[model samples]
Every structure is written in structure tokens, then in C-alpha cells.
Target: MTDQELQTLVEKVSQESFRQPFCHNARFNQRLKTTGGRYHLQSHDLDFNRLVFEKYGTAELIKVIKHELCHYHLHLAGRGYQHKDLEFKQLLKKTGGSRFAPLLAPVVFQVYQCQQCQKMVKRRRKIDTKKYVCGGCQGKLKFLKTIEA
Candidate 1:
């Protein structure tokens, strides 16, 4: 969805779930690599990872929104908003927000093995066996296979 749509949804969720209007901006942040969402303490803005919706769908995305809202609302009220705080934990459980983001599988990569020591190496980009040697035994490295995981 577009940033405008996300902003509208965030605002709606904030009102319905928290009984508070989210006056700040809410948008998808492509830079969010691991976390599902983030609530800015200074700006009161909400940032969501687009990958959450793309990979897990709307239900999971709503949970993430609620999670961020917990942070947003709690921080604004000058209450305990951190994840470790009792008030934060209680609000999260009450709101049915996800305690942790769903684990995303690591990207597949090419694997190499040392011909002498059989030491394995994995890399996101393919490395030339002619130029690179194994660090373990200073042995020649050979392309093993691609690991899909």
C-alpha cells in the first residue's frame, strides 16, 4: 500500500484501539530491516516495514501497527513505553500486539569449500576461487553449491 493509505490506516487504528488520535505522520520505511515497526519518541511518527505486509499479509501488519501504537500512546502519556516496562507489557497484551516480529528467513547464498581442509564459506555474492583462498588452511577454495535457506 501507498504511504497515504498506511497513514490513514495508522490513524484509524490509533483512534479505534488506543482511543487517541495519531497526529503525527505514519509511513512505510524501506530501511527498517528487522523490526516490524518503530515509533519515534521525539516526532511521535510511526514507521512500518513494508516487508511485513508483503510477506505476512494484513493480519500480521495490523498486529505490528498495534505494537507501534502501544509505544506511541504510552510515550505520549508520559507512561512507561519501553518494551521491558510493566505498563508497556500490559498495554501490549491488552491490545493484542505482537511481542516480537515474526522471524524472516535469511536470504539464500552461494557456498564454497576448501579443497584441503573442507572448510565451508558462505557469501551473498559469488567469489572467484582463483583469487580467494581459504583462511583456515590457506587451501584452494572450490565452489560447492548454493544454499537456499
Candidate 2:
């Protein structure tokens, strides 16, 4: 969904689940890697990882929204909003927000193959084949292709 849609959804979730309004911004952050969503303490804005919606669907995204909203509302109300706070934990559990972000799909990365034994190697970044030999057989490695996992 678009950023506008995300903002609306966050607002809706805040109202429905927390009985509060989310006045700040909420948008999809493509740069967010591991977390499902982030709540900016300074701006009171929320950032959601698009991958959560893409891979897990809207239901999961809503849960993440709820999670971030817990932080948003509590922090704005001058209560504890941090993850370690009792209020945060209670609000999160009450709203059924996900306690942890779901594991995203593994990253897409380059693959290399040892020429001698045909063993495979996976790496997030490209490695110079001449410099890094195969661990098992010390065979020269060649670029196979990039694989999306």
C-alpha cells in the first residue's frame, strides 16, 4: 500500500485499538531491515517495514501497526513507551500487537561455485574469487548468479 494508506491505517488502528488518535506521520520505510515498525520518539511518527506487508499480508501489518501505536500513545501520554516498560508490555498484550517482528525473508545475495568440487557458497556481498578460495577444497570459485531467498 502507499504511504497515505499506511498513515490512514495507523490512525485507524490507534483509534480502534488504543482509543486514541495518532496525530503524527506513519509511512513505509524501505530502508528498515529487521524490525516490523519503528516509532520516532522525537517526531512521534511511525515507520513500518514494507516487507512485513508484502510477505505476511495486511493482517500482519495491522498487528505491527498496533505494536507501534502502543509506543506512540503511551509515549505521548507521558507514560512508559519503551519496550522494557510495564505499560508498554501491558498495552501491547492488550492490543494483541506482535511482541516481535516476524522474521523477514532472507536477503537476496550473490552465489559462488567452486570449480573443482562444484560446491556452492552463498554470500550477501560479492567476494573476489581470486582472493577467497573455497573453504573445503581450496578450489577456485566462480560467480554463479544472484539468488533471492
Candidate 3:
């Protein structure tokens, strides 16, 4: 959905679920890499990751919206709005908001093997084969392949 649509949806969710109006802006933030949504404490604006909708669809997006709205409402009310607070936890549970964001990106691992002992290894980032050696055999390492998880 577009940013305008997201704003309206946030407003609708806030009113329906929390009995409060969302007066601040709500938009899809492509820069959000790991989070489902973010609520700015100062601006009271809500930013949602487009990846959530792209990967999990509208239902998941709505759940994330509800989650951020919980933060928005609770913070504006001058109550405990942090994740560790009892009020935030209660509001989140009462609204059926998601406690955690679903994993949105796959992790890539670079596979390497020891030239002498044939031992295999995996790393999240690429490493210089010339600089690093096999731990088990202390032999030169060679790049094998990359895998995603």
C-alpha cells in the first residue's frame, strides 16, 4: 500500500483498537531493515517496513501497525511505553499485537573448506582465504560456495 493508505490504516487501527486517534504521520519506510515498525517518541510518527507487507502480506502488516500504535498511544498518555514496562506489555497483549517482528531477510553464509584436511566452515560474511586458515588442520582455506538461510 502507499504511504497515504498506510496513514489512514494506522488511524483506523488506533481508533478501533485503542479508542484513540492517531494524529501523526504514518508511512512505509524502506530504510527499516530489521524492524516491523517504529514509533518516534518525539514526532509521534510511525514508520513501517515495506518488507513486512511484501513478505507477510496485509494481515501481518496490520498486526505490526497495531504493535506500533500501542507504543504511540501509551507514550502519548505519559505512561510506561517501553517494551519492559507492565503497561506496554498489557496493552500489547490486550490488543493482540505481535510481540516480535518476523524475520524479513535471509542470512547468507560463505562456505569454505580446508585444502589439506578437507574441513568445512561457514561464515556470515566473506573472509580472505589467504589471511585465514582452517582452525582444525591449520591449513590454507579455499572458498567453496555461498548459502542462504
What ranking emerges by TM-score with the best candidate at the front? Answer: 3, 1, 2
Q: For model 3, how does the per-residue alpha-carbon lDDT over 61-136 read when each residue is reduced to its tens digit?
A: 9999989998998899899999999999999999989999999988899999999999899999999988999998
Q: Which candidate, 1 or 2, would have the higher lDDT against the true structure?
A: 2
lDDT of 1 by residue, 1-149 (tens): 99999999988988998889989999999899988999898888999999999999988999999999999988989999999999999999998989998765577899999999998899989998999999989999999888887
Kindly report which residue stretches of model 3 are placed more than 4 angstroms away from their true locations once superposed: none
Clashing pairs in 3: none
lDDT of 2 by residue, 68-110 (tens): 9988888888999999999999989999999999998677889
**TM agreement with the true structure for every prediction:** 0.74, 0.72, 0.89
- The C-alpha lDDT values of all candidates are 0.91, 0.92, 0.92
- Where's the lowest-lDDT run of ten residues in candidate 2? 13-22
Error of 2 at 131 (Å): 14
Instruction: Give me candidate 3's TM-score against the actual structure.
Output: 0.89
User: For each candidate, how many residue pairs have backbone atoms clashing (under 3 Å)?
Assistant: 0, 0, 0
